[model samples]
Target: MSQDQSSVSRRNFLTGTGAALAGTAAGLVGHSLFFRPSSAGAVKQGFEWPWPYTELDPEKVRKKGHAGYYDGDCAEGALYALVSELQENVGAPYTYLPVQIMGFGGGGVAGWCTLCGALNGACAAISLTSKDFYKLSSELVAWYCETPFPSHTSNELAKNGEFLVNKSNKVFKQTVSNSPLCHVSVCKWCKENECGSGCPDRSERCARMVGDVVAKTAEILNAYHFGEFRAQCSESDLAHSCQACHSKESPYEMGGWSRGKMDCTSCHIKGHASLVDPHHPGK
Candidate 1:
Protein backbone atom coordinates (compact mmCIF):
# COMPACT_ATOMS: atom_id res chain seq x y z
CA MET A 1 0.00 0.00 0.00
CA SER A 2 1.09 3.58 -0.56
CA GLN A 3 2.47 5.44 2.52
CA ASP A 4 -0.21 8.19 2.33
CA GLN A 5 -3.01 5.63 2.08
CA SER A 6 -1.68 3.68 5.07
CA SER A 7 -1.20 6.89 7.14
CA VAL A 8 -4.75 8.03 6.41
CA SER A 9 -6.11 4.62 7.46
CA ARG A 10 -4.20 4.79 10.78
CA ARG A 11 -5.49 8.32 11.46
CA ASN A 12 -9.07 7.21 10.82
CA PHE A 13 -8.67 4.25 13.18
CA LEU A 14 -7.34 6.50 15.99
CA THR A 15 -10.15 9.00 15.51
CA GLY A 16 -12.82 6.26 15.70
CA THR A 17 -11.32 4.68 18.82
CA GLY A 18 -11.05 8.07 20.57
CA ALA A 19 -14.67 8.90 19.83
CA ALA A 20 -15.80 5.53 21.17
CA LEU A 21 -13.78 6.02 24.39
CA ALA A 22 -15.18 9.52 24.89
CA GLY A 23 -18.75 8.28 24.47
CA THR A 24 -18.16 5.44 26.95
CA ALA A 25 -16.74 7.85 29.53
CA ALA A 26 -19.68 10.24 29.17
CA GLY A 27 -22.15 7.40 29.59
CA LEU A 28 -20.45 6.21 32.75
CA VAL A 29 -20.46 9.70 34.22
CA GLY A 30 -24.14 10.13 33.52
CA HIS A 31 -24.99 6.74 34.96
CA SER A 32 -23.12 7.45 38.17
CA LEU A 33 -24.79 10.82 38.65
CA PHE A 34 -28.26 9.48 37.97
CA PHE A 35 -28.02 6.50 40.30
CA ARG A 36 -26.04 8.13 43.08
CA PRO A 37 -28.39 8.95 45.99
CA SER A 38 -28.40 12.11 48.04
CA SER A 39 -29.54 12.57 51.61
CA ALA A 40 -30.46 16.01 50.40
CA GLY A 41 -33.20 14.45 48.32
CA ALA A 42 -36.24 12.37 49.30
CA VAL A 43 -33.86 9.38 49.23
CA LYS A 44 -30.59 9.65 51.04
CA GLN A 45 -27.12 8.49 49.93
CA GLY A 46 -26.30 6.21 52.84
CA PHE A 47 -27.66 2.70 52.27
CA GLU A 48 -25.89 0.92 55.07
CA TRP A 49 -27.61 -1.30 57.63
CA PRO A 50 -28.85 0.34 60.82
CA TRP A 51 -29.88 3.39 58.77
CA PRO A 52 -29.45 6.94 59.93
CA TYR A 53 -31.99 8.27 62.41
CA THR A 54 -32.97 11.58 63.98
CA GLU A 55 -35.15 12.54 66.91
CA LEU A 56 -38.90 12.15 66.30
CA ASP A 57 -41.89 13.36 68.27
CA PRO A 58 -43.70 10.53 70.07
CA GLU A 59 -47.06 12.30 69.95
CA LYS A 60 -46.81 12.73 66.21
CA VAL A 61 -45.84 9.08 65.77
CA ARG A 62 -48.76 8.08 68.00
CA LYS A 63 -51.25 9.78 65.68
CA LYS A 64 -49.63 8.32 62.59
CA GLY A 65 -49.67 4.82 64.06
CA HIS A 66 -53.41 5.00 64.69
CA ALA A 67 -54.00 6.06 61.08
CA GLY A 68 -51.64 3.41 59.80
CA TYR A 69 -53.63 0.73 61.63
CA TYR A 70 -56.64 1.69 59.56
CA ASP A 71 -54.41 1.58 56.48
CA GLY A 72 -52.67 -1.80 56.98
CA ASP A 73 -53.44 -3.25 60.41
CA CYS A 74 -51.13 -3.60 63.41
CA ALA A 75 -47.64 -4.55 62.21
CA GLU A 76 -47.70 -2.48 59.07
CA GLY A 77 -49.19 0.40 60.98
CA ALA A 78 -46.47 0.37 63.64
CA LEU A 79 -43.66 0.15 61.11
CA TYR A 80 -45.14 2.75 58.77
CA ALA A 81 -45.56 5.20 61.61
CA LEU A 82 -41.88 5.07 62.50
CA VAL A 83 -40.29 4.72 59.06
CA SER A 84 -42.59 7.24 57.41
CA GLU A 85 -41.54 9.74 60.01
CA LEU A 86 -37.92 8.89 59.37
CA GLN A 87 -38.51 9.38 55.66
CA GLU A 88 -39.57 12.90 56.43
CA ASN A 89 -36.75 13.53 58.90
CA VAL A 90 -33.79 11.81 57.17
CA GLY A 91 -35.11 11.16 53.64
CA ALA A 92 -33.63 8.59 51.19
CA PRO A 93 -33.34 5.03 52.52
CA TYR A 94 -36.09 5.42 55.08
CA THR A 95 -38.37 6.86 52.40
CA TYR A 96 -37.56 3.96 50.14
CA LEU A 97 -38.38 1.38 52.80
CA PRO A 98 -41.58 -0.53 51.98
CA VAL A 99 -43.32 -0.80 55.32
CA GLN A 100 -45.94 -3.10 53.84
CA ILE A 101 -43.34 -5.85 53.95
CA MET A 102 -44.30 -6.14 57.60
CA GLY A 103 -48.02 -6.51 56.92
CA PHE A 104 -47.75 -10.26 57.43
CA GLY A 105 -46.82 -9.56 61.03
CA GLY A 106 -50.30 -8.29 61.75
CA GLY A 107 -52.40 -10.16 64.30
CA GLY A 108 -49.32 -11.94 65.58
CA VAL A 109 -47.84 -13.02 62.28
CA ALA A 110 -50.73 -13.55 59.89
CA GLY A 111 -53.27 -14.18 62.67
CA TRP A 112 -51.39 -17.18 64.05
CA CYS A 113 -51.39 -15.30 67.33
CA THR A 114 -47.70 -15.35 68.15
CA LEU A 115 -45.68 -12.28 69.06
CA CYS A 116 -47.67 -9.07 69.28
CA GLY A 117 -47.71 -7.40 65.85
CA ALA A 118 -46.97 -3.99 67.27
CA LEU A 119 -43.90 -5.36 69.06
CA ASN A 120 -42.80 -7.13 65.91
CA GLY A 121 -43.04 -3.88 63.99
CA ALA A 122 -41.24 -1.93 66.67
CA CYS A 123 -38.41 -4.49 66.66
CA ALA A 124 -38.06 -4.22 62.89
CA ALA A 125 -37.76 -0.46 63.10
CA ILE A 126 -35.37 -0.70 66.01
CA SER A 127 -33.18 -3.20 64.16
CA LEU A 128 -33.01 -0.82 61.21
CA THR A 129 -31.93 2.20 63.25
CA SER A 130 -29.84 0.88 66.14
CA LYS A 131 -26.98 -1.55 66.60
CA ASP A 132 -28.22 -2.21 70.13
CA PHE A 133 -31.39 -3.70 68.71
CA TYR A 134 -31.80 -6.62 71.10
CA LYS A 135 -31.46 -4.55 74.24
CA LEU A 136 -33.82 -1.84 73.12
CA SER A 137 -36.28 -4.40 71.77
CA SER A 138 -36.36 -6.25 75.07
CA GLU A 139 -37.04 -3.02 76.86
CA LEU A 140 -39.92 -2.24 74.55
CA VAL A 141 -41.50 -5.67 74.95
CA ALA A 142 -41.13 -5.62 78.71
CA TRP A 143 -42.80 -2.26 78.85
CA TYR A 144 -45.65 -3.56 76.71
CA CYS A 145 -46.12 -6.66 78.84
CA GLU A 146 -46.70 -4.44 81.83
CA THR A 147 -48.34 -1.32 80.41
CA PRO A 148 -52.10 -1.33 79.83
CA PHE A 149 -53.25 -1.12 76.27
CA PRO A 150 -55.18 1.87 74.92
CA SER A 151 -53.66 4.23 77.42
CA HIS A 152 -55.70 7.06 78.87
CA THR A 153 -53.95 9.45 76.51
CA SER A 154 -55.00 7.31 73.55
CA ASN A 155 -58.61 7.19 74.82
CA GLU A 156 -58.63 10.96 75.26
CA LEU A 157 -57.25 11.41 71.75
CA ALA A 158 -60.07 9.28 70.39
CA LYS A 159 -62.69 11.13 72.45
CA ASN A 160 -61.39 14.49 71.30
CA GLY A 161 -61.11 13.34 67.65
CA GLU A 162 -57.38 13.91 67.85
CA PHE A 163 -56.32 10.61 66.33
CA LEU A 164 -55.79 10.48 62.58
CA VAL A 165 -58.71 8.06 62.57
CA ASN A 166 -61.49 8.30 65.13
CA LYS A 167 -63.00 4.86 65.08
CA SER A 168 -64.33 5.01 68.62
CA ASN A 169 -64.87 7.58 71.33
CA LYS A 170 -65.71 5.13 74.12
CA VAL A 171 -63.19 4.63 76.89
CA PHE A 172 -61.71 1.13 77.01
CA LYS A 173 -60.88 -0.78 80.16
CA GLN A 174 -57.13 -1.28 80.11
CA THR A 175 -55.63 -4.57 81.26
CA VAL A 176 -52.01 -5.66 81.65
CA SER A 177 -51.25 -8.95 79.93
CA ASN A 178 -47.90 -9.53 81.67
CA SER A 179 -46.94 -11.23 78.44
CA PRO A 180 -46.02 -10.08 74.95
CA LEU A 181 -47.85 -12.85 73.17
CA CYS A 182 -50.66 -11.51 71.00
CA HIS A 183 -53.13 -14.13 72.20
CA VAL A 184 -52.59 -13.22 75.81
CA SER A 185 -52.79 -9.52 75.24
CA VAL A 186 -55.86 -9.66 73.03
CA CYS A 187 -57.70 -12.21 75.16
CA LYS A 188 -57.10 -10.23 78.33
CA TRP A 189 -58.28 -7.06 76.69
CA CYS A 190 -61.29 -8.91 75.27
CA LYS A 191 -62.23 -10.46 78.61
CA GLU A 192 -61.94 -7.10 80.34
CA ASN A 193 -63.88 -5.24 77.65
CA GLU A 194 -66.38 -8.13 77.35
CA CYS A 195 -66.20 -8.08 73.57
CA GLY A 196 -65.43 -10.69 70.97
CA SER A 197 -61.95 -10.64 69.50
CA GLY A 198 -63.51 -9.84 66.11
CA CYS A 199 -65.64 -7.00 67.44
CA PRO A 200 -65.24 -3.37 66.33
CA ASP A 201 -64.40 -2.42 69.89
CA ARG A 202 -61.57 -4.92 69.84
CA SER A 203 -60.37 -3.53 66.53
CA GLU A 204 -60.47 -0.04 67.94
CA ARG A 205 -58.61 -1.24 70.97
CA CYS A 206 -55.87 -2.68 68.73
CA ALA A 207 -55.74 0.54 66.79
CA ARG A 208 -55.14 2.41 70.01
CA MET A 209 -52.60 -0.25 70.96
CA VAL A 210 -50.73 0.50 67.78
CA GLY A 211 -50.67 4.14 68.71
CA ASP A 212 -49.39 3.49 72.20
CA VAL A 213 -46.68 1.06 71.10
CA VAL A 214 -45.44 3.12 68.16
CA ALA A 215 -45.33 6.22 70.29
CA LYS A 216 -43.21 4.39 72.84
CA THR A 217 -40.99 3.10 70.04
CA ALA A 218 -40.54 6.63 68.77
CA GLU A 219 -39.62 7.85 72.22
CA ILE A 220 -37.08 5.05 72.59
CA LEU A 221 -35.54 5.69 69.17
CA ASN A 222 -35.39 9.42 69.74
CA ALA A 223 -33.66 8.88 73.07
CA TYR A 224 -31.10 6.60 71.45
CA HIS A 225 -30.41 9.14 68.71
CA PHE A 226 -29.78 11.83 71.28
CA GLY A 227 -27.60 9.52 73.47
CA GLU A 228 -30.21 9.75 76.19
CA PHE A 229 -31.57 6.21 75.98
CA ARG A 230 -31.70 4.11 79.13
CA ALA A 231 -33.07 0.64 79.78
CA GLN A 232 -35.99 1.31 82.09
CA CYS A 233 -37.47 -2.17 81.73
CA SER A 234 -35.96 -5.46 82.73
CA GLU A 235 -36.74 -9.15 82.91
CA SER A 236 -39.77 -9.90 85.09
CA ASP A 237 -39.08 -10.89 88.68
CA LEU A 238 -40.49 -14.33 87.95
CA ALA A 239 -38.31 -14.58 84.89
CA HIS A 240 -35.24 -13.60 86.85
CA SER A 241 -35.80 -16.42 89.33
CA CYS A 242 -36.48 -18.94 86.56
CA GLN A 243 -33.49 -17.80 84.57
CA ALA A 244 -31.24 -18.23 87.58
CA CYS A 245 -31.51 -21.96 86.94
CA HIS A 246 -32.35 -22.16 83.24
CA SER A 247 -30.64 -19.38 81.32
CA LYS A 248 -27.31 -19.14 79.53
CA GLU A 249 -25.86 -17.38 82.55
CA SER A 250 -27.00 -20.02 85.00
CA PRO A 251 -24.27 -21.96 86.84
CA TYR A 252 -26.23 -25.20 87.26
CA GLU A 253 -25.28 -28.16 85.05
CA MET A 254 -28.83 -28.51 83.69
CA GLY A 255 -29.08 -24.76 83.73
CA GLY A 256 -28.06 -22.75 80.65
CA TRP A 257 -30.21 -25.16 78.66
CA SER A 258 -32.84 -22.52 78.19
CA ARG A 259 -32.57 -19.15 76.53
CA GLY A 260 -34.50 -15.89 76.13
CA LYS A 261 -35.81 -13.35 78.62
CA MET A 262 -39.54 -13.75 78.21
CA ASP A 263 -41.67 -14.12 81.36
CA CYS A 264 -41.43 -17.73 82.54
CA THR A 265 -44.82 -17.65 84.23
CA SER A 266 -46.41 -16.84 80.90
CA CYS A 267 -45.78 -20.34 79.56
CA HIS A 268 -44.68 -22.41 82.57
CA ILE A 269 -46.24 -22.98 85.95
CA LYS A 270 -44.55 -21.98 89.21
CA GLY A 271 -44.79 -25.67 90.14
CA HIS A 272 -41.73 -26.35 87.93
CA ALA A 273 -39.57 -24.76 90.59
CA SER A 274 -40.84 -27.25 93.15
CA LEU A 275 -39.41 -30.04 91.03
CA VAL A 276 -35.94 -28.68 91.66
CA ASP A 277 -34.10 -28.58 94.99
CA PRO A 278 -35.21 -26.20 97.73
CA HIS A 279 -31.91 -24.36 97.17
CA HIS A 280 -32.84 -23.61 93.55
CA PRO A 281 -32.67 -19.97 92.53
CA GLY A 282 -36.32 -19.13 93.08
CA LYS A 283 -36.62 -21.36 96.11
Candidate 2:
Protein backbone atom coordinates (compact mmCIF):
# COMPACT_ATOMS: atom_id res chain seq x y z
CA MET A 1 0.00 0.00 0.00
CA SER A 2 2.98 2.33 -0.38
CA GLN A 3 2.26 5.54 -2.28
CA ASP A 4 2.84 5.13 -5.98
CA GLN A 5 5.27 7.28 -7.98
CA SER A 6 7.69 7.28 -10.92
CA SER A 7 11.20 8.59 -10.47
CA VAL A 8 13.97 9.98 -12.71
CA SER A 9 17.07 12.04 -11.94
CA ARG A 10 18.58 14.85 -13.93
CA ARG A 11 21.30 13.41 -16.19
CA ASN A 12 24.05 15.95 -15.64
CA PHE A 13 27.05 16.98 -17.69
CA LEU A 14 29.08 16.36 -14.51
CA THR A 15 29.64 13.06 -16.27
CA GLY A 16 29.49 12.94 -20.07
CA THR A 17 26.36 12.82 -22.17
CA GLY A 18 28.06 10.08 -24.15
CA ALA A 19 28.53 7.93 -21.07
CA ALA A 20 24.93 8.39 -20.06
CA LEU A 21 23.77 7.38 -23.51
CA ALA A 22 26.04 4.36 -23.44
CA GLY A 23 24.72 3.38 -20.01
CA THR A 24 21.18 3.69 -21.25
CA ALA A 25 21.94 1.57 -24.31
CA ALA A 26 23.63 -1.03 -22.17
CA GLY A 27 20.68 -1.09 -19.81
CA LEU A 28 18.29 -1.33 -22.72
CA VAL A 29 20.16 -4.37 -24.03
CA GLY A 30 18.62 -6.09 -21.01
CA HIS A 31 20.64 -8.67 -19.10
CA SER A 32 22.70 -10.82 -21.45
CA LEU A 33 25.94 -11.02 -19.51
CA PHE A 34 28.24 -14.03 -19.73
CA PHE A 35 28.17 -16.26 -16.68
CA ARG A 36 31.43 -18.03 -16.05
CA PRO A 37 31.03 -21.56 -14.84
CA SER A 38 31.50 -22.02 -11.08
CA SER A 39 34.04 -24.48 -9.63
CA ALA A 40 31.87 -27.02 -7.88
CA GLY A 41 29.97 -28.90 -10.56
CA ALA A 42 29.45 -25.50 -12.13
CA VAL A 43 30.12 -26.77 -15.60
CA LYS A 44 27.73 -29.63 -14.97
CA GLN A 45 25.16 -27.36 -13.43
CA GLY A 46 25.90 -24.66 -16.01
CA PHE A 47 26.69 -21.94 -13.50
CA GLU A 48 29.08 -19.06 -14.04
CA TRP A 49 30.69 -15.90 -12.68
CA PRO A 50 28.91 -12.62 -13.50
CA TRP A 51 25.44 -14.01 -13.58
CA PRO A 52 23.30 -12.92 -16.50
CA TYR A 53 21.49 -9.69 -15.88
CA THR A 54 17.79 -10.17 -15.79
CA GLU A 55 15.14 -7.52 -16.30
CA LEU A 56 13.48 -6.91 -12.98
CA ASP A 57 10.05 -5.61 -12.15
CA PRO A 58 10.84 -2.93 -9.60
CA GLU A 59 7.57 -3.37 -7.78
CA LYS A 60 8.08 -7.11 -7.72
CA VAL A 61 11.50 -6.78 -6.14
CA ARG A 62 10.17 -4.10 -3.76
CA LYS A 63 7.35 -6.30 -2.64
CA LYS A 64 9.80 -9.16 -2.26
CA GLY A 65 11.95 -7.14 0.15
CA HIS A 66 9.08 -5.47 1.97
CA ALA A 67 7.43 -8.81 2.68
CA GLY A 68 10.55 -9.81 4.56
CA TYR A 69 11.23 -6.39 6.06
CA TYR A 70 9.66 -7.19 9.43
CA ASP A 71 11.74 -10.36 9.70
CA GLY A 72 15.22 -9.36 8.49
CA ASP A 73 15.13 -5.59 7.68
CA CYS A 74 16.63 -4.07 4.51
CA ALA A 75 19.97 -5.80 3.95
CA GLU A 76 18.62 -9.25 4.65
CA GLY A 77 15.48 -8.67 2.63
CA ALA A 78 17.23 -7.42 -0.51
CA LEU A 79 20.26 -9.72 -0.41
CA TYR A 80 18.23 -12.82 0.28
CA ALA A 81 15.74 -12.10 -2.48
CA LEU A 82 18.41 -11.49 -5.13
CA VAL A 83 20.52 -14.49 -4.12
CA SER A 84 17.49 -16.69 -3.83
CA GLU A 85 16.51 -15.84 -7.38
CA LEU A 86 19.97 -16.78 -8.63
CA GLN A 87 19.97 -19.97 -6.57
CA GLU A 88 16.65 -21.03 -7.95
CA ASN A 89 18.01 -20.82 -11.47
CA VAL A 90 21.67 -21.76 -10.96
CA GLY A 91 21.24 -24.28 -8.10
CA ALA A 92 23.83 -25.76 -5.66
CA PRO A 93 26.74 -23.42 -4.83
CA TYR A 94 24.67 -20.37 -5.65
CA THR A 95 22.31 -21.58 -2.97
CA TYR A 96 25.27 -21.99 -0.62
CA LEU A 97 25.37 -18.24 0.06
CA PRO A 98 24.59 -17.36 3.69
CA VAL A 99 21.85 -14.84 3.02
CA GLN A 100 21.05 -13.98 6.63
CA ILE A 101 24.59 -12.85 7.33
CA MET A 102 23.74 -9.55 5.62
CA GLY A 103 21.26 -8.47 8.30
CA PHE A 104 23.88 -6.49 10.20
CA GLY A 105 24.27 -4.06 7.32
CA GLY A 106 20.89 -2.38 7.71
CA GLY A 107 20.19 0.89 9.53
CA GLY A 108 23.91 1.50 9.73
CA VAL A 109 24.18 -1.78 11.57
CA ALA A 110 21.24 -2.45 13.86
CA GLY A 111 19.05 0.45 12.66
CA TRP A 112 21.45 3.27 13.52
CA CYS A 113 21.44 4.35 9.82
CA THR A 114 25.08 4.53 8.71
CA LEU A 115 26.17 3.12 5.39
CA CYS A 116 23.06 2.39 3.39
CA GLY A 117 21.71 -1.09 3.86
CA ALA A 118 20.90 -1.11 0.15
CA LEU A 119 24.55 -0.67 -0.81
CA ASN A 120 25.60 -3.05 1.93
CA GLY A 121 23.26 -5.72 0.61
CA ALA A 122 24.07 -5.08 -3.04
CA CYS A 123 27.82 -4.99 -2.37
CA ALA A 124 27.64 -8.41 -0.74
CA ALA A 125 25.96 -9.68 -3.89
CA ILE A 126 28.63 -8.05 -6.06
CA SER A 127 31.44 -9.62 -4.01
CA LEU A 128 29.93 -13.03 -4.43
CA THR A 129 29.50 -12.74 -8.21
CA SER A 130 32.24 -10.52 -9.56
CA LYS A 131 36.03 -10.31 -9.29
CA ASP A 132 35.61 -6.67 -10.25
CA PHE A 133 33.84 -6.02 -6.97
CA TYR A 134 35.36 -2.60 -6.45
CA LYS A 135 34.58 -1.40 -9.92
CA LEU A 136 31.17 -3.02 -9.87
CA SER A 137 30.26 -1.75 -6.45
CA SER A 138 31.60 1.65 -7.35
CA GLU A 139 29.01 1.80 -10.07
CA LEU A 140 26.36 1.13 -7.44
CA VAL A 141 27.76 3.68 -5.01
CA ALA A 142 27.77 6.33 -7.71
CA TRP A 143 24.29 5.42 -8.85
CA TYR A 144 22.96 5.84 -5.32
CA CYS A 145 24.25 9.39 -5.26
CA GLU A 146 22.75 10.19 -8.63
CA THR A 147 19.36 8.58 -8.12
CA PRO A 148 16.20 9.77 -6.35
CA PHE A 149 14.43 7.94 -3.52
CA PRO A 150 11.47 5.58 -3.88
CA SER A 151 12.31 5.59 -7.56
CA HIS A 152 9.57 3.10 -8.07
CA THR A 153 6.33 2.98 -6.13
CA SER A 154 3.63 0.44 -5.53
CA ASN A 155 0.78 0.09 -8.03
CA GLU A 156 -1.96 1.06 -5.62
CA LEU A 157 -1.58 3.85 -3.10
CA ALA A 158 -3.13 2.33 -0.05
CA LYS A 159 -4.47 4.98 2.27
CA ASN A 160 -3.93 2.77 5.28
CA GLY A 161 -0.24 2.29 4.44
CA GLU A 162 2.65 4.29 5.87
CA PHE A 163 2.55 7.04 3.28
CA LEU A 164 4.00 10.47 3.96
CA VAL A 165 1.40 13.17 3.62
CA ASN A 166 2.96 16.57 3.92
CA LYS A 167 1.50 19.46 5.99
CA SER A 168 -0.54 20.29 2.92
CA ASN A 169 -1.90 16.75 3.09
CA LYS A 170 -0.43 15.92 -0.28
CA VAL A 171 1.28 12.57 -0.70
CA PHE A 172 5.03 12.86 -0.35
CA LYS A 173 7.10 12.79 -3.52
CA GLN A 174 10.61 11.56 -4.33
CA THR A 175 13.86 13.50 -4.03
CA VAL A 176 17.35 12.87 -5.35
CA SER A 177 20.04 12.07 -2.81
CA ASN A 178 23.54 13.44 -3.34
CA SER A 179 24.93 11.27 -0.57
CA PRO A 180 25.25 7.48 -0.29
CA LEU A 181 25.17 7.33 3.50
CA CYS A 182 21.84 6.24 4.97
CA HIS A 183 21.98 8.85 7.68
CA VAL A 184 22.06 11.70 5.20
CA SER A 185 19.47 10.09 3.00
CA VAL A 186 17.10 9.75 5.93
CA CYS A 187 17.74 13.26 7.17
CA LYS A 188 16.93 14.75 3.79
CA TRP A 189 13.75 12.76 3.58
CA CYS A 190 12.77 13.84 7.05
CA LYS A 191 13.30 17.50 6.23
CA GLU A 192 11.57 17.57 2.85
CA ASN A 193 8.69 15.24 3.65
CA GLU A 194 8.18 16.66 7.13
CA CYS A 195 8.51 13.29 8.78
CA GLY A 196 10.57 11.90 11.63
CA SER A 197 13.24 9.20 11.68
CA GLY A 198 11.01 6.84 13.63
CA CYS A 199 7.98 7.36 11.43
CA PRO A 200 6.59 4.34 9.61
CA ASP A 201 6.75 6.38 6.44
CA ARG A 202 10.48 6.89 6.88
CA SER A 203 11.09 3.19 7.25
CA GLU A 204 8.90 2.40 4.23
CA ARG A 205 10.69 4.96 2.08
CA CYS A 206 14.07 3.40 2.81
CA ALA A 207 12.73 -0.08 2.39
CA ARG A 208 11.34 0.87 -1.01
CA MET A 209 14.81 2.11 -1.99
CA VAL A 210 16.07 -1.44 -1.60
CA GLY A 211 14.01 -2.46 -4.61
CA ASP A 212 15.70 0.14 -6.79
CA VAL A 213 19.16 -0.96 -5.66
CA VAL A 214 18.39 -4.61 -6.36
CA ALA A 215 17.04 -3.79 -9.80
CA LYS A 216 20.07 -1.65 -10.57
CA THR A 217 22.41 -4.33 -9.24
CA ALA A 218 20.97 -6.70 -11.79
CA GLU A 219 21.37 -4.10 -14.53
CA ILE A 220 24.98 -3.26 -13.74
CA LEU A 221 26.03 -6.86 -13.09
CA ASN A 222 24.41 -7.96 -16.31
CA ALA A 223 26.24 -5.23 -18.17
CA TYR A 224 29.49 -6.17 -16.41
CA HIS A 225 29.21 -9.82 -17.42
CA PHE A 226 28.74 -8.96 -21.08
CA GLY A 227 31.79 -6.63 -21.17
CA GLU A 228 29.52 -3.71 -21.94
CA PHE A 229 29.74 -2.35 -18.43
CA ARG A 230 31.81 0.74 -17.79
CA ALA A 231 32.73 2.32 -14.49
CA GLN A 232 30.72 5.56 -14.20
CA CYS A 233 32.27 7.38 -11.25
CA SER A 234 31.47 11.05 -11.64
CA GLU A 235 33.15 14.02 -9.94
CA SER A 236 29.92 14.12 -7.98
CA ASP A 237 30.95 10.89 -6.26
CA LEU A 238 33.78 12.73 -4.53
CA ALA A 239 34.07 15.59 -2.16
CA HIS A 240 37.27 16.25 -4.13
CA SER A 241 37.47 19.68 -2.60
CA CYS A 242 37.98 17.99 0.73
CA GLN A 243 39.46 14.69 -0.44
CA ALA A 244 43.05 15.91 -0.42
CA CYS A 245 42.70 16.64 3.28
CA HIS A 246 40.42 13.85 4.46
CA SER A 247 41.00 10.86 2.22
CA LYS A 248 42.77 7.75 3.53
CA GLU A 249 45.55 8.42 1.05
CA SER A 250 46.19 11.61 2.97
CA PRO A 251 48.95 11.58 5.61
CA TYR A 252 46.39 12.10 8.37
CA GLU A 253 44.44 9.11 9.54
CA MET A 254 41.40 8.63 11.75
CA GLY A 255 41.64 4.89 12.29
CA GLY A 256 39.31 4.43 9.31
CA TRP A 257 36.31 5.69 11.31
CA SER A 258 35.92 9.03 9.51
CA ARG A 259 36.28 7.40 6.11
CA GLY A 260 34.05 5.85 3.46
CA LYS A 261 32.16 6.51 0.18
CA MET A 262 29.98 9.19 1.72
CA ASP A 263 29.87 12.86 0.90
CA CYS A 264 32.08 14.67 3.45
CA THR A 265 29.30 16.76 4.95
CA SER A 266 27.41 13.59 5.75
CA CYS A 267 29.54 13.45 8.89
CA HIS A 268 31.69 16.60 8.96
CA ILE A 269 31.31 20.32 9.23
CA LYS A 270 31.87 22.02 5.87
CA GLY A 271 32.57 25.67 6.64
CA HIS A 272 36.24 25.23 7.51
CA ALA A 273 38.89 23.00 6.03
CA SER A 274 41.62 21.48 8.20
CA LEU A 275 43.84 21.74 5.15
CA VAL A 276 43.78 23.81 2.00
CA ASP A 277 42.02 22.70 -1.17
CA PRO A 278 45.06 22.59 -3.42
CA HIS A 279 42.96 22.47 -6.57
CA HIS A 280 41.40 25.80 -5.69
CA PRO A 281 43.75 27.57 -3.34
CA GLY A 282 42.12 30.95 -3.86
CA LYS A 283 38.85 29.71 -2.35
Q: Give the number of the best model, judged by lDDT.
A: 1
lDDT of 1 at 153: 94
Tell me how far candidate 2 lies from the true structure as C-alpha RMSD in angstroms: 13.2
Report, for every candidate in turn, its global Cα lDDT versus the true structure.
0.83, 0.64
- Give per-residue CA lDDT, model 1, range 1-283, as digits (tens): 2322445433344355445554433322221323434333445344666688888899999999989989999999999999999999899888788999999999999999999999998889998888678778888998998898889999999989898888889999999989999999999999998999999999999999999999999888888888688999887887887677788766658677788778888877646665666665544
Pairs that collide, model 1: 42-92, 43-92, 44-92
Per-candidate clashes, comma-separated: 3, 4
The sequence of per-residue lDDT tens digits that candidate 2 reaches over residues 190-231 is 888889989888776766677668878877876777649987
Name model 1 segments beyond 4 Å from true.
Answer: 1-46, 271-283
**Residue 44 of model 2: what lDDT?**
35
| Model 2 per-residue lDDT at 233 | 63
